[model samples]
Target: MIWKLSLTGMKTRLRDYMILFSGLAIAAAIFYMFESLATNKEFLEHSNTVSVVGIVFHLGTVLLGIITFVYILYANSFLMTLRQKTYAMLMMLGARTSKIAQMIFIETFVAGIAATVVGMVVGVGLTALVNRLLVNQMGIVVSHYTPFNTAALLVTLIFFIAVFLIASMINASSIVKKSILQLLNEQKTPTRFKRNPFLLFIETIIGLLSLAIGYYFLAEIVKFQIMGLAIALVTIILGSYLIFHSVVIFVISLLKKSNAVVFKKLNNFTLSQLSFRVRDFTQILSMVSILFALALGALTVGLGFRNQIMTFTNTAATYDIVLNNAQKIDQQKIDTLDPTLNVTYDQKYDDTTIYYIKEQFDQHPFEQKDQSVFLSGEVNDKTLKYDAAKMEQDEQAQKALQDLELPEQKEKQIKLISQADFDTLGLDESQLQVINVTDFTTILPQIKTLIEENEKNNPSLGGAEGQNSFSQKYYVYNLYNTFFSGFEFMGFFLGIAFLTMLASCLMFKILSSANSDAIRYEMLRKIGTRQSLLKRAIFKEIGILFLLPGILGSIHVLFGLQMFKNFLSQPYHNIWIPFTIFIVLYALYYFATIWIYTSIVLPKEKRN
Candidate 1:
């Protein structure tokens, strides 16, 4: 008889059970996808550029675990509420408390086991699909990647089982404590506003201060290092919570006091619902804000790094194939490039007497070495060294250098010409004109190779020592690859983390408060309040809830990105790409949340 009753209870509450199962399944799938990249030690070690990437993944797992744990607890609590009245009836019929407790535990465990089995199957399939997409997007073959990680599956199952067992015990204990009368009368009570102006003021001030400190640390990330990152993170999280707790109330109060907008149209009803709803959800609101900031930051930085790579590649090279010793085969290879290719050619030389009279004067006050070979086929290692003692002792080098003191040796005169001496160099008229410094820097690699070939063929012209002299004349382009790599990697991870947290927090909050909302909607229907009005209220309420976090978080990201301007060559370039992507994702989640919330909260109305 007890088993029959338990099975009937499960059948009756199938909708609620389905919600619980679906939520867990989605969470598991996302977790598995993250783990596929994070847990593969060899893949992460090889592909990841950030030194602390493994640590970041560990932290991500911990955060996701906490969110999932909380979600499960909340879902179980709702299930307990649904069973409370039935349990009371059983107790009245002389069923033992211990028997009821045992039955409840069995039900909870059954639900958990069922959910886990389905979730794991879904997770494994999703992991395989996501891995394939990521591989294609990145254009890299990742070996040793396992979509079906036995360890991840085991860990997820164990962790979820423990959570369910703990929740079951709590539910069982609650059943033991509650009287039959209280259980029969159990229904959601309307939440009341408990305003304390002084507390609100204090919270607002503290929150502002925390936010300020977080911004300061973010701005000076280089100096304060990891300590700053930790502090900023903690402070920002705290501040966001306090802001939701205090600032949201303060805004609602201000809206209520306004005569023009508060009492106008549906604003009064909408604002009332927002105030009451937000009052019960201060922590969730704060969490949503943090996630929004993280998501936007990640997408922005990731796209920025990609843009930088393209820019660097474009700026470094002008021609597809630039060769001084171009053979017939080499020319054919160049011709086989993309049909849209463009090419240009310059003269070839075997020996060149390039003069650096101005550089000698700049280096020495007296005329000792009047000329230096700026380019040669065979670069001599010795010419690269600067002999300060020998340069200082020459009186003629001193006299030549007295009036015009140069900033650096590289900026001084360095000359290069074709090895074919002026006549047989085979130079085109346009190529004969000396290239501008700006343009020359872009083609420096081609120029260096050309010089090397010429000196190789004509060894009499500065060969070994001259090679070193040529090396000293040129500057190596510093693109700062290290810095961009770090930003790109961190950005991608941060984006994913933020979106996951945001969706979970908002989804949980909506679902948790849904039971109360159902009654409110029912009351509205019984009265003159139209079904349409109730829906509009729901839509407006959700809109405000989602909009506030996104707007404020975007503002924070804008100011935060300003701090990176000094470091990035084109910090603001293509910034819109990330923003657009964020908006599209955010909007989809918002619409999905509204649909889910309505399905859970709205009564079945007749279609006109």
Candidate 2:
């Protein structure tokens, strides 16, 4: 009998159930996606150069787990609300409370498992699609990464099943504890907007002060680092909440007292409705705003790093390739790049020391003063000294001589010899060639081939030696790939997950209250209020709700981006790209929420 009732109730509210199902599925899918990356040890090892990649993935897993848990609870609570009145009716018809609780548990558990199953399937698809997009967009080569993984599947299944079980129990218990009368009267319960002048004053002052401090800390993040981030996170979140709580109420109150605004059209009704719902709306708005900031900030930072990959590479080393004792094949490969500039230095090496002619260096200078610029000065004839203090003080000269080491050679003293002395040495001579190409990225394939050949010929210069050697083009290539595939990869997916979850939170929260709001709309309809006017009221009200958060969130992003300035040359570079994308998505959600809310409350027009 309980099974029959549960099925009937589900069929009756299939649309609402679909919303619940999709929300839960999205939560599950995002969790599964995160797990896919976290569980892929081989992929992490291959793609990331960061030492703490495991720790980063662990933190991400915990964060996503917490977010998914909270989302499931909220979604389940909405499910409970949708069926509460129906349960009350059954109890009044002589059904036992225990029976109803059993029915609720069965429905919740069944729906959860169904969503989780669908989510895992969708997760695989999303993993493939997102991975492809990242690879193409960022030019990263990820190996040993599969869209479907048994470990990820198992972890996702275990985590979501446990969450669903806990949620089902909580939902069933909450329903059973409430009396039938309370359940029936739940929608009709009145909500009030409270305003205490002294408290409001204090909150307003503190909120503004908190925001100021948070902004200051975020802007100066380089100096304070983690401590600054902690303070900023706390203060900004608190400030957002308090500011919304107090300021929104104050503004609505002012509008309520103004005859010019309140007496206009349906403005009075709108303000009254806002006043009643402001307390709840404030919390949602604040949360949504913060989530928006985080989502957009993540995407912006990720794209910033991606766009500046070449710039960062150039910063580390000026020349595309610097080869000691260039071979014929190497010169041939270098020629294929249509060399913009080719500078070679003549050198001779004896038993205890390597010598470079001073005149050769002066004639065609190839020393780097900075990351990109070449040094402009005459070379002095002196023995090269490896003084740590002197090298640290003269970073430009240190960087210029960074590629002094050669394969299978003992550490030897380097000296600048006169042309006459260099010619008289009779030691074996070699040429160190520095090649520059018009575009570094255009010749990456050839560069890789050349590097592999070099490493093969000189087995002593493999792995760490090749990777850390600034003179090797392979270093730039590897660094570029690692940066995009590591932190940037994580950032992009995190943004997408947060954006989906938070938008659903706002949509579900609004829709959950639709039934409670239905009676008021019906009352307005009976009193000759046109459906058109009602929609306009909804547009105004919901539009305000969307607008407030968007404005605040954008402001947060503008300030929050300052924190990345130390890491990035220009953190705000290409920021509008993410902002534009977010605005379009957010606007779509805004309109979709209104349509869903309107469908629940308004009557359909009759045909002639």
Candidate 3:
């Protein structure tokens, strides 16, 4: 009997179940995609700048995991709400509470198992598609990495199943304890908004202060170290919550004070719905804002590094190939390439050197002094030394050349000059040769040959070296490929994770309080509200819900990028690329949310 009942419930609530299923599937797929990178120890090892790659992936995992957990819980709660009245009726019909609890458990477990199976399949397809895109963009053949990871699959399965079971148990217990009257009255009661003045005041002040502190710490990331990052994280989260809880309420209240405007043109209904929604959703709104900020920030940072790679490569040299410590065959190989290409040979010695200059009295007169300066204001006989030995031997003076690892007197003899001077020496610049523009389209095979030869001969200078050693030697590709690859991979994964969380949170809150909203919509329909107006109301409500978090998140990312200024050689370069990407993704989700919400809240219109 229970088996038939469960199947009927599943069929009847198929739409709601699909929402939960889709959310889980997206979460699983995104998680698998991320893990393919994070857990691939071999891939990370092969990367040139493996320094922060692990850290970035680790943080990405943590953020994604938190989002997944929150989304699953909310989704499971939606599932429970769909069955609440039925569960209540079962208890009222003399069915044992324990039996109903057992039924709820089986239903939830079944849903979880079904979602996981479907999600894993979707996840594999997404991973393949995204991985292919990245490989093509990067222009390097990455070994075919597996999309299906056992550990990741197990972890995702365990997490969702546990959450579903817990939610089902909570729902069952709540139903078991409630009086039949309360159970019947649940759908009719309206949830009231409670305002505590002192709490609001405290939260508002603290939130503003937290945001200020977070901004300060982020701006000075280099100076304060990891403590700054921690402080920024904590304060920003607190501030976001406070902003949603208090600042948003304050704004709405101010808007409500104008009686004429508040009630004008369906504004009253809009504001009332927004107020109720916001009051219940402050924390989730705060979290969503933070996630959006992080997703955008990751993309921005990746693009920034990519821009730096391009500019650094383009500006530093004028060649497709630069070989340092070359061999005899290497020269022949270079000569065989297109004759029009400019090949400049140069020698580079690995050494640590420094220099000190002696002052000439006539050229730099001692008496040309500015006595207004209290401390050593001018070049004077007493303060200025001409003796190189004296300058080098002085312990205080010698400290400046400590990086050179030479006797102070020996270090003083070295002077660095421009490449123009070295070229005049005419000795083959110790094995460093720059090959100027060969056709980019035709040069791939030749470049590949050069890379293989160089790796064979030197055994240390890996692959084809380009203009900037950093990009070619390190990133192993041109600027465009590197930047595009990183952006595509990171953006797609982060976008999926973020949108899933956003939709699930919005859906959860809307559906949880949906019984009340059903009445409100019904009342409006009876009172001659054009179905269109109610539809508009639904759109406006959901729009505000998505818009607030998005705006705040964009602001956070804009300022957050400032923190990277000190570290990146060209921080702001190509920033618009990521911003444009984010804008498109955000706009799509916004419209989609409105459509989804409308379908859930409003009934279908009648045909003429």
Candidate 4:
């Protein structure tokens, strides 16, 4: 009999179950993706920026895990609400509480396992898709990554199953303890704004200080590093809760005090409605806002890094393409590109350096360019002098060069020698193919391929000979861009996961209290409140609820993005693009929230 009841309940709330299932699956999939990169030292070993990337993915995993855990609690709480009244009815029908608790456990456990299986499948697919998109679509190569791992799968199942059991036990316990009368009255939440002003003031002060401290640490995150992040995390989260719970209530009360505004058309009703729910769901609102900031901020930083790639190339390379050991196929590919200025020459190199005579590059001097946020340089006729890559900066690098026992300075660089100097060296010349293009980005793919092939055929051109291939600036920049692309991918992927979970949390919270809202709306309607006014009121109330988080989140992100200024040349560049994306997403969710809320509250005669 319990089994039949559980099945019937599952069928009844299939839509809610679907949201929970998908949220769990995506969360697991994203976690799998991050762990694949973070734990795989062998894979991270390939990139120059491996350490930074590894830290990012590791932190990402922890963050996602925490948020997922919270979401599970909230989601399960919602599930319990769905069954509370039913459980009450069953108890009235002579069903034992313990037996009902067993039924609840089985129902939750079954649903969890089902979601886990489907989630694992989706996780695998997402992993493969993310890897492919990062490597292929971004014109980058992140080779030797495992998308589907047995350990990750096992971890996902054990973790989620444990979470489900705990939540189910809590849910069942909470229901069983409540008297039949309380269970029956679960939908009716009294709107009682009762609080001490002095206590509220003190809480707001503590909340502000906490937020201030968090921002301080985050601002100088480079100084504090991970420890700072931990501190900031604790403080900011606590502060956010207090701010929403205490600060927001005080501010809304001030608005309520204004008689002119309160007497305005439906303003009084909307604001009153908002205040009532705000007190009950303060933590939810705070968390929703924080998560929104994280989601929006992640995508913004990703787009910013992506945007910086093209800019990085603008200055990082003077000659768009540089090929050593010019093969016939390479020449054909370069010819297809139709470069604005192409130079094919020869140079001499031993173990430590590649050298070309000044006269060789004198005919068509390559443009020397420099770009930065504060300073910019124009293209000028400059002979090849410095190394294509940045000069080695540390004492250890110089010592390492000396230890290697290479030529004079032991600093591998492009050398400009006078003819007399070149004659003295007596080193054999290596064929060189170089090009200056008007537009490199358009044919970046062919250029990227050409550069990769050359690096593969001649490892000596890369560094101080015997080192990993670090080709010309253009190619290496693209490689760096690829690494950052992985960073971008991580951010974008995690953002989607957080957004999904947050939307689920907020929507469920709103809908779960819907039965209570129905009574209020019914009372209002009987008092001659038109459906249109009520709808506008509904829109106003929900809009404010949605907008509060958005505003708070915007504040978080505005300050949060400053942390990335060092990594990104212009962190705000094209920032509007991501904001637009976030707006669209938030708007869609907002309207959807209104629709769900309306359906539950209003009569069917005026749903449109």
For lDDT, the strongest prediction is: 2
> What is the C-alpha local distance difference test score of each model?
0.61, 0.74, 0.63, 0.73
Error of 4 at 504 (Å): 1.5
Clashes found in each candidate (C-alpha, N, C closer than 3 A): 20, 0, 3, 0
Model 1 per-residue lDDT tens digits across residues 123-150: 7887677556545433336776778888
Model 4 regions lying over 4 Å from their true place: 12-15, 29-62, 92-94, 124-128, 138-155, 177-191, 310-319, 324-435, 448-468, 606-608
Summing lDDT over every window of 10 consecutive residues in candidate 4, give the lowest-scoring window.
397-406
lDDT of 3 by residue, 115-167 (tens): 77787778778767766665565565667577676776776667667766776
Q: Sort every candidate by TM-score, greatest first.
A: 2, 4, 3, 1
The best-first sequence of candidates by lDDT reads 2, 4, 3, 1
Candidate 2 local distance difference test against the native: 0.74
Question: 361-456 in candidate 4: lDDT tens per residue?
Answer: 555443344233214322223333323221233333233223222223246555566668887887776555667777767777776677667767
Query: Per-residue lDDT of 1-608 in model 2, one digit per residue for the tens?
Result: 88888888888877767877886787677667767756666655654453244454556667777767877787678778778999998889898878988888888887888888998999899877766764564444677578997887898889988988898889989998999889988756656787797788789899888988999999998788899989998999999999988888888888888999998878998887777756667878888888888877877887776765665666556567766566534466777889887877677887777777776666755445253222221122222433333443554564456454465443555577678988898788777677778987877778767766766655666544453365665575565655555557667766776777677778776787787677888888888887778889989988888888888888998999888766666677778888887888788889988988887777455100
For every candidate in turn, the CA RMSD to the true structure comes to 10.6, 5.0, 9.1, 5.7
User: In lDDT terms, how accurate is model 4?
Assistant: 0.73
C-alpha positional error of residue 215 in candidate 3 after TM-score superposition, expressed in Å: 2.9
Error of 3 at 554 (Å): 2.2
TM-score per candidate, chains pooled = 0.63, 0.87, 0.72, 0.80
Clashes counted in candidate 1 amount to: 20
